[model samples]
Target: METLSLLADGFSVALTPSNLFLAVVGCILGTVIGALPGLGPSNGVAILIPLAFSLGLDATAALVLMTAVYYGAMYGGRISSILLNIPGDEPALMTTLDGYPMAKAGRASDALVLSGVASFVGAFLATIGLILLAPMLARIAFLFGPAEYFALYLLAFSTLGGIASNNQAKAAIAACIGLGISMIGLDNNTGIARLTMGELHLMDGVDFLVAIVGLFAVTEVFVFIESHGKNSALGVKLGKITIPVKDILRCKWTMLRSTFIGFIAGVLPGAGASLGSFMAYSAEKSLVRDNSQFGKGDVRGVAAPEAGNNAAAGGALVPMLTLGVPGSGTTAVLLALLMTLNITPGPTLFTDRPDVVWGLIASLLIANVVLLLLNVPMVRLFVHILSVPPWVLLPGVTMISFVGIFSLSGSTFDLLLMIGFGAMGFFLRKLDVPTVPIILGILLGNNMEDSLRRAMVISGGEWTYLFSSGIAIGLWVAAVLGFVAPMFLRGKIRKPQAITD
Candidate 1:
């Protein structure tokens, strides 16, 4: 009953004229960004962060806009997957398995509509789950001490590498890089400059907003330049957009099951939508007696992954909101946004900032409905986004990054630093290094350090004190298992080839 009351209060905030307008704009922009292959939700949100700040949106308003974009991008990823056999992001990779085949079979419209519905189902149900689960999880988190928190942060870093990168070693290197960068500012305890290297601006440390823009937004511009701004897709032609009711009914159970699976996967720190999509599709395949049609245009194939990944997207928010651990790479980005807003997300967040927490949850519910309604009729509009030439789009993105970053601190040095990070990110991508872990490390390093220091101080510097509590030991064990499980899981998962026809 209290949850319901809070949700009602959240709806009041979400329904405000300005907030609703931002949500609509964010959804449309997110869909367009999602339709463009390779941009993904992280980049979309990163690019828009400056705009949110420039507009001086309050905490609740800003969060609402970004989370709406997050959900919208999840819906939009399927557009490219179905039409061009290209994934809009990592999580959408599975959608191409069956979505493109359906398009090739002259069911492009059906595929788009069905996938949209499935996305709606997954996201909607997942939001409901978040409402029920996050509070309980937050309550549980209230029991964590410094040692347990330190162990939990370690677990996040450990598990993150497995799902975020193909090679754990590369992920570790990225994390070290992030930790090194995070150490640039003055030490909070002693007020001593650590990595300033004599530059005054360095004393405050590198702003995460700058790094995020450089790594996620500006790096894409360089990547586009390297690719010579080419659009080579032989796009699919859409017929009349129509809902496939029969197919929706056929896949009802699949959507429900995939939602459950994806939500669980999303809640697990570091196991994100990519795993959720894969697990949902693989599970559906295994459950079916006649599974030969899975990669060859089966409607169930389209529904499972669409539902699964979207659910995972919602699920990823739980840990970010309740425990300050991002469940996915995108949620890591969102975590940065929260910290920048001077809002610390943890168990106290519910009591201290009920408006922000419940308001975000309410906005998500609205965004899901808004996305479902907008996606079907605007299918043609979003599909046209795929046709936008990179030459036209790349410059706009570059301008936004430049303007947005400058608006934040009005610092030319930060701009240069952003470009430097962009170049570094470009090289890192070339080296098959994941940037998400680096961001995660940077985001959590200070907190992790503080936790460790506090734990040691409390335990009189005894190392065994790290393992003194059951929660601490459990987290340590989970960290070890989280790091190792992905290696074996990756080998067992069969990746379906995208249809290139």
Candidate 2:
């Protein structure tokens, strides 16, 4: 009953005339970004963070607009993957395996419609899961002590490094680098600068938004430049938006299973949308008899991963909202936005700021509906977004990143930092190492350190306090398994890779 009243209040806030307009515009812009190769939701939100501030929008309004874009981009990413054989991000990679083949077989329109419907189903169902589970989960979080939080953050990092990256050693190195970066600027405890390297601007830590935009948006621009003048064309004509009833019936089980898998995966720390999609694809292949058709344009093949990835996106929100710990790269960016807005997420957020929490949730429900309506009828409009030249789009994105960061602090140093990180990001991508863990490390590293220090203080510097509880012990065990299992799997796959290379 209380939840209902809060939701009603949220609707009142979200349905305001201006907020509604922003939501619509955000959805459209998000779709455009998602349809373009190399511009995922993280980059999309980071690039546009400046626009929200420039317009003088409040935190709630800005978050609603950004969240709308986040989901909208997830919907739009499928178009390029299906038509051009290019994934907008890692999660959409599975979509290309079957989606492109379907498009090549002259069913581009059908693939588009089916993917839209599947994405809507996954998102809607995941929202339902969030609505029901978030409050309960938040309540459970209230029981955690600093010791437990330290353990939880450790679990998050270990799991993230394990599941999000294929190479554990590389992932660990990336995480250490991010942690080192986070340690820059003045130390909170001693009030002394640690790693400024004698630069005056190094007194303040690197802005999260600047680092995100530089690492994702700026690096992406460099990559697109390398592909400049290449023949990356959308060849097939979009014939009609029609999803046959029989196909829906056939994939209904796949969709349902993928939703559960995605939600569970999203709830876990370090596990992300790509892992969810990959696991769902593998699960569907194992369950279906004619698995031989998976990479050759199987409809179920398309549905499972699409459903899983969208659901995972929603699932990633769980930890961010309830625990104040992000579960993925995109959520880490959202966490930065929340902090910038003076909104502190955690168990108390639900009680103290019911309006923001419920309003965002309600907006997500509306955004999914808006995305579905926009995607089906305006499919061609989204496809046309791909025709934009990189020269025009890259500069526009760079401008947005520059303006947003400057609006917050008006610092020239921030701009230089953005460019430096952008160059680093480009090289990181070239090395096949995941950037998500780096973002996760930067966002959570300080919190984890604080929690660990508090836990030790409470325990009188006793090391056994770290493993005092059954829950903490269990979490530690899980973290170890998460890190080790990937190494074993990678070793098995490495032998076959050597032959191919």
Off by over 4 Å in 1: 231-236, 488-490, 493-501
Residue 126 alpha-carbon offset, candidate 2, angstroms: 0.3
Error of 1 at 57 (Å): 0.8
User: lDDT of candidate 2 vs native?
Assistant: 0.82
Candidate 2, clashing residue pairs? 50-404, 160-270
Using lDDT as the measure, which candidate wins?
A: 1
**lDDT score, candidate 1, position 24:** 92
Worst 10 residues of 1 by lDDT: 492-501
Tens digit of per-residue lDDT, candidate 1, span 1-501: 999999999999999999999899888888888878768888888878887888889999999999988898999999999898889877898999999889999999999999999999999999999999999999999999999999998888888786656788898899889888988889977889998989998998998889988998888888888988654454557899888999999999999999999999899988888888988999999998889999999999999999999999999999999999998889988998899789999999998999999999999999998999888877988887888777777788888889999998999999999999999999999898989888888898888888989999998999899999898899999998877877888776433333354
Candidate 1 backbone clash number: 0
The C-alpha RMSD of each candidate to the native structure, in angstroms, is: 1.7, 2.6
lDDT of 2 by residue, 195-293 (tens): 899988878887777788889888877887877825355344777667667777888889888888887877787776776777777788899888999
Question: Model 1, 307: alpha-carbon shift in Å?
Answer: 0.4
Clashes of 2: 2
lDDT computed for candidate 1: 0.89
